[model samples]
Target: MIHIYLCEDNNRQLTRWKSVVEKYLLMNSTESQLYCTANSPDELLEIRKKSTVTGLYFLDIDLQSEKNGIELAQEIRKYDPRGYIVFVTTHSEMAVLTFQYKVEAMDFIVKDEIETLPDRICACIKNAEVKYKTQLDSSSRLLSVKVDKTSLILDQDDIVAITTCEDYHKIMIHTKHGVRQMSGSLKELIAVLNPAFCQCSRSAIVNMKHVVKYSREEALLTMDNKETYSVSIRMLGKIQRALKQL
Candidate 1:
């Protein structure tokens, strides 16, 4: 189920959004709920931390607080990168600010058009449902590995690099969140990974999607997260070909 949150300072507007969202979800039989509502950025952020699943957020661009809507959305991304954000505001002209903030908002709903607010919010929810479902369909993107008696299921996109650890039988899986060590070999892990990963070196296999820049002369690769990894000369041609596919 998807969690829906709303942040609006105006009490009347807040109530209206809550009512419309709830009614729409009930009428359409959507597997979602109006989880929480807040009147300030801080309050909403506090509520956001408790969300266990990807959420749909409706934020007012001009919140009467220290941080406005766009700023709040920026903070939200730090915790929930894949969550959907929709800006519901009276400042229609401020739509361009979402781009400047690089928040990747799902939609911008102008509150001044009161008649259309319900429809717009419902549309955003529908889009979020589709995107979230697509993300959950991880048949080709999931990396499942076993460690001891436990099974670890990881999303391949969250993985940054998989390399052989100092231990002969242990491999380290570097992810956006942190690192994990499992008793295995890079060769075994690579066999299960998708083509988006490239064996850049004998010791390291980097996710090509996260690689930012590659220097053949230097034999180095920089990832989107600013981590650097060595690329073996033999794998340079393979890396180049894989990058082209990206």
Candidate 2:
């Protein structure tokens, strides 16, 4: 689901942009939940505070409020760093201010050339999805695992490798002092992780961040600790692509 926010002061332009965005979403077979705010930066900020946005934003520079769209964008970034922001304005000169908010702003669009605006917004949303997934995976949550009747809350990031054993899997995690082992099945353990941690073999689903080297010919993954695990030939390409993104 994509949540889009539009901040435009002009009634005519706001309606037109909303129509264009709706058409684009319909054509792409995607559902968009849109929040429209006209000329009010305070209302826009309030909407953001109440919503969990996952998509792009179309903001107008010449807002009716004292704070322009650029200033509101900086404020938005404080809470939602992953949302895509596109500034829309009649004044092309305001494009220079993009440098100040480039970290949050994905692109700037001229109001007259609104024909090309939908494509840019769609592209930015796609890019944001990829980045959002990466960020979510990098910040894996802690989980408690029971091994031989002993329960432990393991830091997911400390996990170096995981391998299946009969009906269970052995998880090798690196602590500040040394490595420790926990028991669980690949399927059971994998459900707790994001897509970034992919299965490289029938017996193993390794953390992409822990992978330091890989050999397609040898069908193996070498972790930062110098331990090598066998990678199935069929899953090698998938593992390689995932690692390359890192």
Candidate 3:
């Protein structure tokens, strides 16, 4: 299920957005639900921590927090890079920083324009519903990996992990298809990988989608196929943050 998250500190503005979003979802018959309306970034993050699902975020720029909406989007990306993020702000001057953040923001709406605010918000949600549907229909994304000697193409979604083999100056690409030793480094391999692939260590990178179990006791990550990888204690923090929560 798709969830909508709204974070606005102002109670009156929050109520207005909530009403519009509720109406939009009902009118379009979108199964998506407005999960929570938050007055702070922490509140929204807490709600997401409890549920693992596709999400659309509409955040106000100035939350009066040290970390603003842009930073909130960055934090959300740690767990869900594919989640749609739209910034809602009263100040238009802050709009220029959206591109600088590289959060793949869908749209920026200025709240001062009360007349057009609902229309803009409705449009972004409608477009997001279409985009999320297309992603669901495809299920998996594909990528081509090129090496000096051979070219290999595979489903990026099937990848379990990519690790550096220092001996051969190559990368051991592990996928559901099986392991393939390709001439590449984690640095080079990561450049082509999708956001689902996260660097757990200087040597290892794992596809968060394939991590079925993570053991803090053993500092190990168990894959869907039951293959286990020892996660470095230092990188464990980042690995946990990037991994999808149940």
lDDT of 2 by residue, 120-214 (tens): 66666556545554554466644556755755544455567677554444655443225656675678877886565888887777878788887
Model 3 weakest 10-residue run by lDDT: 146-155
Order the candidates by lDDT, highest first.
1, 3, 2
- For residues 1-246, what per-residue lDDT tens digits would candidate 3 score against the true structure? 468999999999999999999998766644467998999999999898886667899999999998899899999998788899999998778777878988988898989899999999999888887787667547645455665554444556667998888676788878664677777678877886777887877788898889888888988888886777887878887788887453
Clashes of 2: 1
Residue 165, model 2: Cα distance from true site in angstroms: 32
Q: How well does candidate 3 match the true structure in TM-score terms?
A: 0.57
**lDDT of every predicted structure (CA atoms):** 0.85, 0.70, 0.82
lDDT of 2 at 177: 27
What is the number of residue pairs that collide in model 3?
0
Task: Give per-residue CA lDDT, model 1, range 189-218, as digits (tens).
Answer: 888888789898989999998988988788
TM-score of each: 0.57, 0.52, 0.57
- Between prediction 1 and prediction 3, the one with superior lDDT is 1
